[model samples]
Target chain A: MAALRQFLTLNAQILYWTFVAPFAGKPTVRIDAIFQQMVRIGVQAVPMAALTSLSIGLTLAMQGSHELARMGATSYVPDLLSITLLRELAPLLTGVVVIGRSGSAITAELGTMKVSEEIEALEVMSINPIRFLVAPRVIAMIIMLPCLVVFSNYIGFVGGWIICNFALDINTTKYIMRLIESADMMDLISGMTKSFVFGWLISVISCQSGLAVTGGAEGVGRSTTKSVVLCILVMLVVNAILTGMFFIIEGPKG
Target chain B: MSETKRETVIEVRDLVRKFGSRTVLNGISFTVEKGDTMIIMGGSGCGKSTLLRHIIGSLRPTSGSIKIFGEETTTMSPQQMEKLRLRFGMNFQFGALLQSLTVGENVALPLIENSKVDPAIVDLVVKMKLELVGLTGFENLKPAEISGGMRKRVGLARAVALDPELLFSDEPTSGLDPIMTAVIDQLTMDLTQKLHMTAVVVTHDMASAFRIGTKMIVLGAGKRAGMIIAHGTPDDIRNSPDPEVQQFIRGEPDGPVPLKLAPEDYIDRLLGHDRDKGLSY
Candidate 1:
């Protein structure tokens, strides 16, 4: 019963501070801090994200083009790559990369700080830890992850194009032009929207799991694991929701 | 020591903190007076740090009150607690220095974070605190760059940055080498006395506790402690015949005060039938 009460209270506290208050109060988060944390969480996350996206684009295009040739529909292959990469693949891939690179690292760093009493030290020093640490991370992700997603979409499409056009002897201009025509404003918007939701997913889940850490080194590790798993799951869920909204009924008109 | 006399600075009453099904601190009570350094000593997991957290209003009690300088801190609002905490400072075991900042910046944090103090004044205060702990010119160094002893000192500097009336330290020398431990102990004593600040330290360090404690509270076993146990000067605690005090002070292997384990477990361990004994080596 006591354990239940503690769990409820801790949960309530996290919800209140993390979600409820920020929305309710119209809190003015510092712009400079947001930019600074973006450099830390998002900018620092680039290398890993780029690697994952490149590999995903290469592998998927190579296999996808093989199936296209077997169907005697090699020319239409750009459409498949276009819709798949933009509407599903690029955003999902980038989301996973960010979860591993930014999400886990943030959780571990903050968790260690919590265990070491650095958070308490901030409290005693009249500094709000959430404002100084959490707010910036959230703001940075919201601002930068979409831009990163846009970049990932570009690179991944190019990755597929390079494989399809050069490696598979497809007409280069025809493929690019076909992709540009088939890929409407909605596909790009949906892709960008996925990035936005993913950014929120990564930040909120990671910060929560990190702050949940208590005790020592083991606790920090546990928090980091939970953060990555939860962020990825949430990102995938949001991805599914966005894909259904943009692609299922609207088709080419969207 | 300069006509050593101090007044009651901290008054704790019926302070309680519970973790899950077990109540760690059950109606614990104590007082720390000004110019007096009180040590809260206990066996590991004896709720000493819990009690310290309660005093600072960091951990709210299940039920009870803490009056620091006669203000009822237990019921204070978050803002009120922040205001009240300005009167207090803490040094935690891990030093708690902001890793993003240098040692100078870490010390300057209290001033910068709390108030729009003049940059020049903040610098000087940071220097004064650093100098007090014999840290001198190591300001630009980050916590990652410093030794453990130096990190603890940087934490101490940050703690006293605000010049708090009541200073609390949690296991100030838990990880340092012996020489460093002694240096920290002497610093706590000299600084506490020199500054005329009231201090409450939660520690398991017998020698340091004996050396620096003007008043001491020994926490013993219970899901909630049965009592705060012995209370008085360091000599008073050393001479105490209470089984808990004797066992803790002497670092004895066994006693009437049940080690934080169940009766069957204790007996099995005592008879050497158990394969694993965590606290008992």
Candidate 2:
């Protein structure tokens, strides 16, 4: 209950700092700080996100074809791969990648700052740690996670296209047409929405864990491990619920 | 013509702080007047740091009053406390600088964030502050690149960047060589005398504390823990009748100021048993 309260309080604080505080004449986080975090949380994770999505795409294609070929419907690979990547795999896999990469990094960085009294130093300097250190990171994560998901969606499609065009003897035009037809804007929107929530969850969870750190180096290590595990678990559960909701809202689209 | 009163910068009254069942600060009270360098000295874990935190509004007393700049801070909101904090600066024992920012940026932080100082002036002020700490022209180095003494200097530079009316330093001279300790002590004295800034310093270094402190208070240890045993001028403290005060100032190990554990307690603790009830071999 205390943990939940801390999370909610942190969420409220972050929201106020990011949205309401500036209009209240409180200093908003600097653009450069947000950009710095964006580079760290989003730009730097590109290679790992791309690699993860590409591998998932390839494996999905290979496994899907092996099963579908038995049913003599191997040509449907593009439709299935595109739909799965758009509606689920891209956002989910990208979130996991970010949890492993940026989420843990945020926790470790802030936890070290907490143990080292840098956070208190900011406080004594009349600087709000949330406004200066956390809000920018949270805003960056929220903005960047969806962008990575969209990028991952395309990268996954490219990986599947490779398998289909070369391995399955399917033509590029046919594969592209099948993918375009099978996936809708709604699929992209739903997936992006999920990614957006995942972004908020990851950054908040990581920052909360970091800020709550006690002890010293071992405490930072513990918080980082806990942040990653919590992010992954929360993402998975939230993904399942979001997918269910999307299914209900979109009504089993064919 | 009436005489002007020395303005009270920090007035802490009967400040009490407890962690669970252990009382760390017991009815502590003190007042820091403008231009006074108040040294808070104690053995390790004697709650001098805790008292400093209370005075600086970092930690609220369990039950008591802390007034900074004549405003009661015990019940002040965070925003209000922040507003109050702008008038003062604090230096941590370990520098506590943001490792990510360069030394120059660290010094420039409060000025840039709190004030609308022009970027050029901010740069100039950063250089000036660093120079005051005798760390000229090393602005671009990361905190990790700097030595411990240099980091402490940077921390001091950053603390006085805003030219605050009051400064709080926790173990500013700890972990430094004697010459470096004196250098820091001289800087504190300069800030107090030249700038007319009030200071509250928490430290165990007797020489540095005596050198810089116009007034001093020594927190007790062991049985008398968390209570101020002596409070007066540096000379008065030197002639204090309390054995604990005499022992502390003289840096004597054996005295009436008991160690954290007595012999029986230490034996019991090592034997993992209750006091006077440990298993006999």
Candidate 3:
């Protein structure tokens, strides 16, 4: 219950400093730091994200075709593969990967700063620690998570295409047509929306864990582990709720 | 003692802090006058560092008031407190220099963040402060690359970069060799005297405290947690009649501050009679 209150309070502070309070000319946001975080959070994670999405995509295609061929419905392989990857796998898998990589790193970095008294030093220097240390990272996560998801979605589709054309003996034209017809614009938007929320969750939870750290080196390690676990767990729960909400609102047109 | 009338810069009244059920600071009060070096001395866990943190607005007291430059800090908003903090500087025990930034960049941080000074002017000020702390050519190196003594000096340079009205140092000589401790003490004295800054320092080093402190307070332990057992000039502290104060100043092992475990308890444990059944080592 104490942890819940701290999380909510930290999130409220982050929201105000990042969005609402900045308009008052205080300029809580630092563009340079945001840019640096983007490179760290988004650009640097590209290869890993692409590789994971490709592997998942190929496995989904191979498994789907094997089952569908037994039922003599092999033509439905592209449709199943595209819909599953677009509506669920792309965003969820991307979130898990980033949580393991970037979320843990962010927590460790800030936790070390807390242990070293750098955070207190900033405060003593009349600097707002949330604005100076957290805002840029949170903003970068919000902006970059979706961008990475979009890249993952594209790479995942290509991976499916390669598997369907060669291993499944399906024509490229037929696979493209079925995939295009099976998934709609709503599927893409809903997936991207989930990515955005996941990004916010990862950044906020990691920052909170980092700032709440005590002890020393042991505390940092503990906080980093907790950040990754909490991020993944929260993303899973949020993913289910969001998927349901989008299903209700968009009415399952695809 | 001195002919000049001194104005009070910091006035802390009945400050108390409790962590859970354990009270760390208990009704501590003191006043620091402008241009005075007020040394806060205590053995480990005596709340010396905690008191410094409360005065600097890093930790809030459980009860009582702290007026800095005549403004009540306990009731100030974060933004308001930040503005107030602009007039003060704090040097941490471990230097607390940002590992990512170079020594020069670390010193230049306050100038960059608090003002829109020209880049060249910032560089000049950084160079000047580094030189004052005897770290002129070590500016480009990261904190991890420097020695502990050098890191402390860089921290001092950074603390005085803005020429703040008040300066707070926590264990400035804690980890240094005797010579390095003297050098840091000299630098601290120079900065306070040259800049006319009111300073509050927390340390257990009697030698360093005596050399730099114009006035001093020593905290008491146990049931009198965080209470000041002694407050006076260096000479008065040196000649104090209080056993605890004398024991601390003389660096004696056998003092009023009790050892961790009593001899009877140790013998009881050795006899396999556990008084603390819940404790595990």
Candidate RMSDs in Å, in order, are: 5.6, 1.9, 3.1
Model 2 chain B is weakest, by summed lDDT over 10 consecutive residues, at: B272-281
Summarize candidate 2's per-residue lDDT along A109-196 as a digit string, tens digits: 9999999999999999999999999999999999999999999988998899889989997889999998988888988888999999
- lDDT of prediction 3: 0.89
lDDT tens string, model 2, B45-130? 99988888888888878898988888999999998999989999899989999999999999999999999989999999999999
The better candidate by DockQ, 1 or 3, is: 3
Which pairs of residues have clashing backbones in candidate 3?
Answer: none
- Provide the clash count, candidate 1: 1
Clashes of each: 1, 0, 0
lDDT of 1 by residue, B154-264 (tens): 888888898888888988888778887888888788768898888889888888888898889888774326357888888888899887789889998777765477887
DockQ winner among the candidates?
2
Q: Pick the candidate with the highest lDDT.
A: 2
Give per-residue lDDT, candidate 3, residue A82: 74
True-contact fraction for model 1? 0.68
What would the per-residue lDDT of candidate 3 be over residues B1-281, giving only the tens digit for each residue?
Answer: 35587778999999989999989998888899988999999879888988999899889999999999999999889889988989988999889999988999999998988888999999999999998777889989999999987898888888988889999998888788888788788877876788788889998888889999999999987766789999989999999999988988888887687655698877676766874675455
Ranking of all candidate structures by their DockQ, best first = 2, 3, 1
lDDT of 3 at A63: 90
Ten-residue region with minimum lDDT total, candidate 1 chain A: A6-15
DockQ of each: 0.44, 0.91, 0.73
Candidate 1 TM-score, true structure as reference = 0.82
